[model samples]
Target: MMRKQTPWLALALLTLAPAALAQKTKVDAPPKKLYCWNENGQRVCSDALPPEAVNYAREEISAKSGLRTGEVNRTLTAEERAQAAAEAAQRALDKAAEDTRRRTDQAMLMSYRTEDDLRRVFNERTAIVDNNVQTARYNVASLREGLISLLQTAGDRELSERPVSAEMTQNIRLRHAELVRQRQLQASFESQRGELDIEIEDILQRYRTMKGSLPADSAPAATTP
Candidate 1:
C-alpha cells in the first residue's frame, strides 16, 4: 500500500510543477513600460507617471527592451484650443456652403435643357425690369415738367406783387415729391437690371462648365437663330 501511494504522489507533483514555475516566472518579469517626460527642461523617467507630468508630453518605453513604444501629446493651451475650435467651425461653414452650391448647380442643370432656354428666361426677366425702368423714367419726366410750370407761375405772381395761393403751393410740393419718388423707382429698376445681367452671365458660365463635363452624346448642341 505504501509503494502504490508513492507513485500517485510523484504523478501529481509532476503535473503541478510546470504551473508553479509559470506563475513564478510571470511575477518575476520586468515591468513592460516606463513613463518619461520633460521636467524643468530635464528628462524625467519613472515606472509610474507623476501628477506634474499629466499635462506634459510623455513617452512610453519598454523597460526590458529600452525601446520607445508610444507617445502622449501635451495638453493644448487656451489660445490653441480657441484656434482649433475656430478652424473646426470654419470647416463646417465651408462644407455647408459647398453643399448648397452643389445643390444649386444640380438644380440648374436639371431645369434648363439648353443654354438658350436659360438665356430666354433671363432675357424675359430683364425685359420686365426694363419696362418698369422706362415707365418710371416717363413718370419722372412728366412730374418734373409739371413742377417746373408751377414754379414759373409762382415766380410770375411774386414779380407782379401778387401772393402765391396756398392751393398752388401745395400742388408744387406734391408734384416735387412725386418726381423724387419716381426717380428713386427708376434707379431701383436700373439696379435690378444690372444685377440680372451679372447673374445671367454667371449662370451661363456655370452651365457651359456643366455641359462640358458631360459625355458628348449627353450634351446639348448650340442652337442657331
Candidate 2:
C-alpha cells in the first residue's frame, strides 16, 4: 500500500510537464534555412546545398523569416578570369595614357606664354627642317645628274659595240642608289615639316583650352603676329 502523494509534489510535476515538452520540441525541430542557387538556367531551392552547387552563386534565407540572411559568391571560371584580367590591363593602359596626356599639357602650358610663342618656336623648327630639305634636294639633283651622265656614257659605249666596264657598271649602280637615298632623305625632311605643323596646331589647341579656363588676370596676354 503506497502512501498518498503529497499535494505539493503533485503540483510540481504538473508544472514541469509543459517546460519539459517545450525543451524536447526545440531540440527535435530541424534548423530553419533555405538555400537557393541557379542550376541549368533555373532557380533551385533546398534546405541544403549539394557539393556541385558549392561552386555556384547561392543565397541563404531564414525559413522562419522568409528573408535572405547570407550569400555565397561562386568561383570564377577560367574564361571569366581571363576576361577580367584583360579588362584590368586595358584600364591600366588607359590610365597611363591619360596621365601622360595630362603631363604633356602641363608642360606645354608652362613652356609657352602665348599661342604666338608656341607658333614661333615651331616655325623655327620648320625653317630648320626646310633648310635640311633644300640641302637634300640639292644632293639628290647632283646625284641624279651624275647617274644620267654615267648612263649616257654607257649608252655611247654600247653604241660603239663595246662592253661597259664592270667598274663603270658598279659606279652607275652606286650613283643610282645614292640618288634614291637622297630623294628619300628629302622626303623625310618634308615629312618632318608636315609633322611639325600638325604638332604645333595640336599644342596650340590644347594651350588655348587651358588658358581659356584660367582667370583673365592670370592668363598670358596674346602677342601680335
Best by lDDT: 1
Instruction: State the C-alpha lDDT per candidate.
Output: 0.89, 0.89
Model 1 poorest 10 in a row by lDDT: 216-225
TM-score of each: 0.54, 0.55
Model 2 error, position 208 (Å)? 1.6
Q: What ranges in model 1 sit over 4 Å off?
A: 1-98, 220-225
Write the residue-wise lDDT of candidate 1 on 132-171 in tens digits: 9899999988999999999999999999999999999999
Q: On residues 1-225, what C-alpha lDDT tens digit does candidate 2 reach at each position? A: 999876998799999999999999999997689999999999999998889898999999999899999998998999999999999999999999999999988776766787777777776778889899899999998998899999999999999999999999999999998888999999999898888778878878888899889887776544445
